[model samples]
Each structure stands twice: as C-alpha cells, then as structure tokens.
Target: MLVQMFDLLATRRDFFVGLLLEHVQISLVSIAIAIVVGGIAGILISEFQRAAKPTLAVVNFLYTIPSISMLGFLIPFSGVGDATAVIALTIYALLPMVRATHTGITNVDPSILEAARGMGGTRMQTLLRVRLPLALPVIMSGIRNMVVMTIALAGIASFIGAGGLGVAIYRGITTNNAAMTMAGSLLIAVLALVVDFVLGFVEKRMGMRSKAAKRTNRRLAVGALVACGVAAACAVVPGMVAGAPATINVATKPMTEQYIMGNMLKDLIEQDTNLKVKVTQGVGSGTSNIEPAMESGDFDLYPEYTGTGWAMVLKKGGTYSEDEFGQLKAGYRKKGLGWVGMYGFGNTYGIAVRSDVAKRYGIKTYSDLAKVTDRLKLGAEADFFERADGYDALCKAYGMRFGSTMQLDIGLKYDALEQGSVDALIIFTTDGKLSHANATVLKDDKGFFPSYECGNVVRTKVLEQHPELRAVLKKLDGTITESDMARMNYQVEEKGEDPEDVAREYLRAKGLLK
Candidate 1:
C-alpha cells in the first residue's frame, strides 16, 4: 500500500508539490499569527490573575469548533481560499499557544523572582532577563503542539476551495481512489512529523542565558517572519490579476463534469483568441461559491447548471415550468451575469440502483422506489444531504423514508452501489459511472427535478470588454451530446486521462480548436 501510494503521487509530482507549498503557506501564516497574538494575550492574562480562567475558557471554546464547520462559517465573509483558511487555522492554534505561555510564566519560582528584584531588577527586567528565560522551554513546547495541530487541520482547508494537500485527499475520496487518498494522508502525516521534529530540536537548543544563544534566537525569529511574509505574498498576489485586461479566469464546481467543462472553456479561449486563461476548478458549494466570485469579478466565467441557477441562485420555488429557461436568463441578467445557450446536455438529478436491484424491486420511477423504502438503503453526497434542493426536499416531494441513508462522497457513491452497501444512489443523469457501474436510473415520474441544462455563466463585464468571447462561447452551443460528456468523464475517471487532455481531444475531434 505504501509503495502504491508513492507511485500514485509520483504521477502528479508538480501538483503534489504545489499542494505541499500551499499547505506550508497556510500553516506558517496561522502559526505566526497565533504566536504573536496568543503570546500577547497570554502575557496580559498572566498579570491579571482574576481574568486567566475566563480568558482560557474562551480560547478553549474555539478549540472545540470542528475544523470544517469553522471553515464554512467563514466562507461568506472571506469567500473561501487562503483568507478563510488562515483565519480558522490561527484561531485553532491559539488555545495551545496561549495556555502554554501562561503556564510557563506563572510557574516561575517566586524565590527566583524575588532574588532578581532584590538585585535591582525592575518588573520588565525581571520578565525579560529572568522569567522569560526560565519559561522558554514550556512556551516552546506549547508552540510545538500548536504547529502540529495547524498542519493537520490545514488539510480541512481544501474543503473551502483553499488549495492544500487536503484537496488531494478529498479528490481521492470523491474519485474512489484509495492509493491517491493514502498518498495525500501520508504526505500530511509526514509534513506534521517533520514540523514537530524541527521545532522540538530548536526548543532543546534554545537557552537565553548566553549572548550567543540570544542572537541565534533573534536570527531564527527573523527567518520565521520572512517565511511567513513570503507565504502571505504568494496567497495575495494571485488576486491582483483578477481584472487584468485580456486575461480570463474560469472556475468550476467539484465534480467530473464541471472539471471537463472548465477545461474545455480554457482550451477553447486560449486557442481561439489572444487572451490568456486561468482555471480554478473543484470549487466547493457549486454555484454558491462560483456565482459570488463572478459577481465580485474575481472569476470571468464557469459552466453552471440551469436548474441550480433557477432554484438555488434565483430562489424560486415549486414545480419546473416551460418558461424556466427564460426566467433563469432574466434572473441572472438582473445580477449582471449572462447565460449562454445550453451546451447540448441536460444532466438532471435521479435516483439510481444497480441493474439487478432495479429488476428485483421493479423500480422504474421515484414513485416505484418509494414503495420499497422500508427495504432500501439510500446513499447521497454530503452537499445533497445539506442543500435545500437536496435529499430532504427530494424525500418530502416523493414521500420516501428509506430503511437507511448514508452520507457519502460523490466519488464513492458508485462504489457503494457496486458493493451492495446501498440499494439506491443519488446520481446525475450524465455521470459516466452510470454505465460503468451498471446502474439503472429511475425516472422522475412526478417531475420533481427541474431541467439542468449545462451552459457557460459569465460576468457581463467580461463579455462587454471582450465582445468576441460571446461568439466563441456560442460556438460551443449544442456541440457535446449526452453520450459525449459521459464518455469524456469515463476517460478521466476510469481510464485515468487528464481532464484537460480529454476536453482538448473532444474539441480537436470536433474541429472546434486548432
């Protein structure tokens, strides 16, 4: 397993290295901020004995919040990526740093302090020359613990579109790639261990008694700050190019289909025009994340599902309507977002089951599945369970109460069905795995789902600036059939082809690109 993990990771060495750099970037920023802020808070509280317990209680409360939940809470305000990741990591690292600083200082021998004061030491002098030196070991121990925790929690940052080693892990989980998942997990563990060992060694070597030791400590502190500054710069510099002329930013949701679409757009634009393109794919929350970024002009365009725009973005309710496309266009236009014509596929949501199970249950529609709810175990993705238009709403509409429902990663849903762990799985109509998994998709006899026609959702401002972009995008209209999408996805998911290569090949085969 270990050898296989390394072999899998070696296939994408550059990507894994970038993940490592990003993981270090956020971890360093969080730890640096924690040490300064937590150190100050610790010093302040130590002098005021009455406030120590209450302050520590507050810091501990932050420690109790789950890492992913904390990242989610900051998404709306920070809008994902490094800002949210760094802030959450900093808060998580605080409890240990603060407690350690306070414990180290307060534990100093009273007799030693009295002797220092009697020897003409002032309050500040006693703290700097005597107390801090004695407390260095304890304080460094807390810092070491915080660094390790931050490194581990940084993996969760990828859930919020923050790039890190965690993104690789989540992608592996979603794609049902055990070797990839193991590789990511092993890298994170290795990173944590390396950080712990280095910090531990430094802690042992530090002794403020000697002038040379004090100079070495100062040099180390300066080096750490420089590294933190470099990380911060690397994170912020990308946002600077958001509105650069003749450059476009494309984004995609976290799914196989979306990834293909994003890559397709990137390839088409770069080849057809003089404009440079950058793609940010596998973003969390689908439209929720992409739409906001588009509105803020952070991203120029992305492939979006019409039904998602109608229901989630437009906030309209009730049954699907004939005028839904018109309504969707108008709704997005109001928000300064333009919707291009559909890209020749309508990938709606449906309940799927293994072919043998479907035959045994006689389930051809959602209503038919409801009849066997008491015997069926349902499986769905994490977002499907949480979204308003997801599992709960689907159940209410179909009157379904399954024997059990397992929350799963989208990538693992097919595997779960093949293994018979789930009787039915929620799936997209165009998923390539449908054929591979030998799953039969049930029809929505009651018209519970709206049309999910895929299209390019772009910022009006971008279209206005590069008017030819609209025409370039329109060239993609009705180009890819449902089968084409499914086959393309299969190539990437099952055959291990890079999404960009799959998309590029599709364009070249269609004579759509040079």
Candidate 2:
C-alpha cells in the first residue's frame, strides 16, 4: 500500500505541474477576456440609469448557474477542448468584473469630477486620469475574483478532454483507486492554494502603490499592454489559413482501440487520398468526445462504437440487436452527425482469464467461472467499473462475487493479469494482448454485453462539404474483422509500431492503397 501510494503520488506530481500550467493559461486568458468584454459591457450598461439594475441582475443570475452544467450546455456548440473551457470560464468571470467596474465608476466623487472639469480637463482625460485611477483597485479586485474562480473551474475542463488536474481526479474516482484519488485531490488543492497566494501578493502590491500618491508606472503598464496584444495576435493565426483537402482531424479517446483506430484512419485516409492528417488523441471516456467535437466543427472524423452511438450519442437507453448498424446510423443522423460506415469489426467486452488459470480451474465459460468466482480476483477498467453492463452489474447477474476485485486502468490491466496479481480481467474482446498471452475469453452464455462495432463519425456539414470523404471511408466496410483489429492494436500498442504504419500496411495489403 505504501509503495502504491508513493507511485501514485509521484505520477500525480508530474500531472500536477502540467495541470498547474494549464490552469494558469486558461485562467489568465479567461480573466483577460472577461476584463475587456465585461469592461465594455459594464460601461455601456452604466450609461442608462434604468438598465443598470436589470443588467447586473442578469449577470448575477448567469454567475449563479453551476459551472459544470454550463460546460455541458456549451459542449454541443463549442465541443470538447481548451476553447470551450476558456469560453465557459470567461463567461463565468464576466459577472464579477462587470459588477466591480460599474460600482467603481459610479462611486467616483462628484466633487472630484467638478474639480477636474473646472481645471479644463476634457471628458476623456478626466475619465482616464481621475475615474480610472480611483476605480483601478476595485476593478483589480474583480479581476482577482475572476482569476480565482476561473482557476478552480478550469480543473473541471478535463471532463471534456481538456487535460488538467481534473483528468487525474476523474480517472482515480472512476477506477476506485484510493491512492490515485488522494494524489489527484491533494495536488489540485495545493495548486489552487499556491495560485491564490501569488495573485493575492500581486493584488496587495498594486493596492500599496495605489495608496501612495504616485500613479502606476506608465512604462510598466505600457509594456504589459503590448505583451497582451502580441499574445492575442498569436492566437488568431491558426484559423486564418485554409486547411488542405486531405487534411483530416481524427479525435479519439486515450489509450483505447478507438484512439488507435482514429490514428489508423488518419494514415489510411492520407495514404489513399494523398492528404495530410492530424490525429488528436486522449479524448475522455464515452461519446463525450464525439458529439462535442462534431457539433463544434473542430474534428473532421473519429472512430466510435455502434453501441456507444446508440446509447450515448443517440441518448437511447435499452437493449438492442447486435446487427443494428442502421439504428446506429439513424442515431448519428438524428444528432446532426454523419456515419461514414463501419471498419468491418466489433470490439466486444468479455471476461478474460490467463491460460494457466483457465486450465487450472477448468473455466471455459462464464457459467463455469461462477463456481470459482468466490476464490478469484477480478480487475476491471475504469469505465467497466461504472457502466451499466460493468463488473457490478455482471456480478449481480451471475450470482457470484469474486474473492477480491479491484478496478484497474485498461492500460495496466494486462500487466496486472500477466503478473498473476489478478485472476481475471474485464477486457475488450479484440484487445491484441489477449491473443499474445494465450488468455481464454469466457463465453458470455447469457450475452450480457452489447455489440460495439467500430466506425467513423463525421460532422454532417463536413460530409456535405466533402462527399467523397464518406465514400473513401466506406471502402473499409466489411474489410477489417475483430481478429484483424486485435492484431493492428497489438502492433501499435505492444509492438511499438506507429499506428499510421500499421494502417498503411493493412491498407496496402488489402489493395486499398497504391
């Protein structure tokens, strides 16, 4: 337990540094955006005496909405990524800054305004020199609030595939791994505390300078303004250029067959069409990656399971026939996404036992395994821990309980099972390692799991724009099988071959590529 805790902590330290940087980046950008946009809105709203109360009320109401729900609402439009996260945080930060700006500007002393007017200062000059100076502290305070809230909110961005400390926490919680959960939670807390302290120090320094009779140093202020302008220009350059015809954006989950398939498709599409492809991996669990990126128009294509499309992407709940490709296609169409066709394969979930263990226990089927389940240990992936058809549900259906069972990450399950630490594991039917290890897949005599055929999901608009893309993808239909997918997965994941290389080779062998 100690060693496991130490390992988790060490891994968390690495993730913490990355999370801290991401938090800083998102919070700073969001706060900056809030200041400029909210400042303008505040100024405009302040112009009308009747509008001020209503405007402030609206902003306050928006601020009261829970951040997570706000993020979910934004997903269909903004999709999953850093952009959505920043936009959501920016909106959340707007209320405090707007309120601060209005209060600061309105509270300017009438006597001071009269004195400035009598001194022959123009409206612009008086507003800039007197009103701004007096209000700077309050505006800064608003900015401080925005900064703190945004940092906290940014941690949750990982839910939508925006990597941060939240990824660690989400992974830990889903896996039921106490060591990982503690490490992630502790690291995030420390990051938040540190950032808050740093910002507080800056706020204090600014306050001290404001109290002194001296104005803020003009050169320092100008330098900061210039730096911000440069950063803004840098961010805008990417969307300007027209992406190439063969360019494809493949989005997929991290360390899974879908991820590998997405990368492979990128290569196959490029090789067959002579186009460029960019693969974006590490998307989080479920159809979370599919709809968001598709709706936002950020991704060109991605691999998804038919059942995932049926239940999650389509939001339809219940058992369905295994040969329901049409249902999956209909579901995607209804959701404004396009289905390009299957990869001629399905990756089913099943219980796997080491060859030696299966031989020892004479366990060839799930029914046989039930007899010895009380003496065996089971390991499951994070998703399998929580999914309706997962270990808990499976156990209930089987009327048996393992002697000891724990959730393990999909990536680590093979190692754990191979080392004899776990007697059985929940795994994808087509996982390459299962073939490599001579493991036995217990037949689901009861057919507990749903079918998960692999296919490409595209934005409806993208399909309209590039009609040929769907045809290109459709060529792969009925070509790859479960065993073939397993070999390909093993080639990339275990044999250290590039996914693109594996894909190209497969395509070439199939005479799909020149």
Cα RMSD of predicted structure 2: 7.9
Angstrom error at residue 297, model 2: 5.1
Which pairs clash in model 1?
Answer: 174-411
The residue pairs that clash in candidate 2, if any, are none
* Candidate 1: segments with Cα more than 4 A from true spot: 1-4, 208-247, 386-388
lDDT of each: 0.84, 0.73
lDDT against true structure, model 1: 0.84
Instruction: Give the TM-scores of the predictions, in the order they appear.
Output: 0.91, 0.63
Best by lDDT: 1
Of candidate 1, the 10-residue stretch with the lowest lDDT total is: 171-180
User: Which stretches of model 2 miss by more than 4 angstroms?
Assistant: 1-27, 31-79, 87-159, 163-217, 241-249, 268-278, 292-300, 311-322, 354-361, 374-377, 385-397, 401-405, 416-422, 436-440, 495-514
Q: Please provide, for model 2 over 1-514, each residue's C-alpha lDDT reduced to its tens digit, 9 standing for 90 to 100.
A: 5676677567556655766666667777787799899998776675555888998888888888887778878877777878888988888889988988888888889899999999999978887889878887788777777777777777777667675666655554433345655666666667667767866766665666553423454555677789878876765666466773546677776554665566567766776665567665556555665566776667778777777667666666555456677777776777678777678888878888888989999999898999999989999866667665567768887887899987776667887888999999888877767777657888998877788877788888777776667778888788889888888778755664545467778877988777
